[model samples]
Target: MEIQYLGHSAFKIKINNTLLITDPFLSDDPDLGIKFPKIEARIVTVSHNHHDHNGVAAVSGNPFIIRTPGEYEVSGINIFGYATFHDEKEGKERGRNTIYLIEGEKMNVCHLGDLGHVLENELVEMLGEVDVLLIPVGGTYTLDAVKATEVVRQIEPKIVIPMHYFHPKFKFKLNPVENFVKEMGVGVPEKTDKLKLSKDKLPQETKLVIMEAS
Candidate 1:
């Protein structure tokens, strides 16, 4: 599998012969002024109704989109969407959010879209074991660094990729990636513009990878 960060919470994942994109925040991002390159995908997944996570216009005209809550299968990929709240409490303000679990290539990838706070027990149980977890660490609209770390511990994914934080172009009040990386306090985190992975080469332990937005 190969992964490319498209800025903000958007990511492109290539698993087997399929391309899966999540939370496409291209074109609409005011800070970066970055326009997304035209790309084709077999499937596109949007976690919620937020503009950052649901840039339907960024996708090619012919791609298949999964937006509602349910189980769907297409081109050998199995996707399960569970309804969850975006804010800390119930949908008092931010309204509903969907967490997606995609199964394919002998791995399960989870994208926590604009997750505002810690998850509940039942939501955690539904997620099960995540091989690759794409999470939001930007606090204003999602979990802060401290809270994100706790979520990572609960999910226990083999690979954790932080997203939704402040960038050069993102106009938000949230802290930058430094906060999260500083808290990690381990070896130097691998910083790359893109990531390539395969089911046969899955890492044994949870690894935090930081990728540059394209």
Candidate 2:
């Protein structure tokens, strides 16, 4: 399977002949100036109902949307959404968020949608071993660099991808990606437009993978 970042928290994951997109941003957002490309997918998973994460209309082909926590299987892809919060206040401040565990072939990928706090022991145990972890590194509305690094340390994913941070088209004043790299004690990350990997090819230890938004 391959994963491609499409700006903000949105990502396109391709498994076999099926395509899955996560967190499509609405066009009404002022920070959005780039065009939402003509994209189609068989499935879509939303972390929350925020304007930046629930633009189902923007995705064509009438894909199945997964937002709540449960077990779902489609096109040989297994999805498990674990309930979480977008703020330390436990959704009182910013509502609930969903942590998606997408299993394809023998690989498991976890997407922490706008997670606002560090993981507890129980949540860490629930996550198990993650081959790839897509996490939020921006502050204010989600986990900042420090908390994101804490989550990374707990989960110990083979591949880590940062999301929901400051970009050229993003108007939010969240911290830069470099801060997350510094927090992780890793060298400057290499940027790529897309990534393809398999179970046998995973790194022996955790590593950060920076993906450029399309």
TM-score winner:
2
Estimated TM-score for each candidate: 0.93, 0.96
- Write the residue-wise lDDT of candidate 1 on 1-214 in tens digits: 7889887778888888799888775685565566776788889999888766777778885778998789999888999998877888777879888889999878898988888878888888888989999988878777889998889988989888998888665555777877887776546778888887777787888889999877
Overall lDDT per candidate, in order of appearance: 0.83, 0.89
RMSD in order of candidates? 1.6, 1.1
Model 2 residue runs over 4 Å out of place are none
Tell me model 1's lDDT, rounded to 2 decimals. 0.83
For candidate 2, the 10 contiguous residues with the lowest summed lDDT are: 27-36
Residue 152, model 2: Cα distance from true site in angstroms: 0.2
lDDT of residue 185 for candidate 2:
88
Candidate 2's displacement at residue 40, Å, is: 0.8
Candidate 2 residue lDDT tens string, 152-185: 9889999999998887777768888889999998
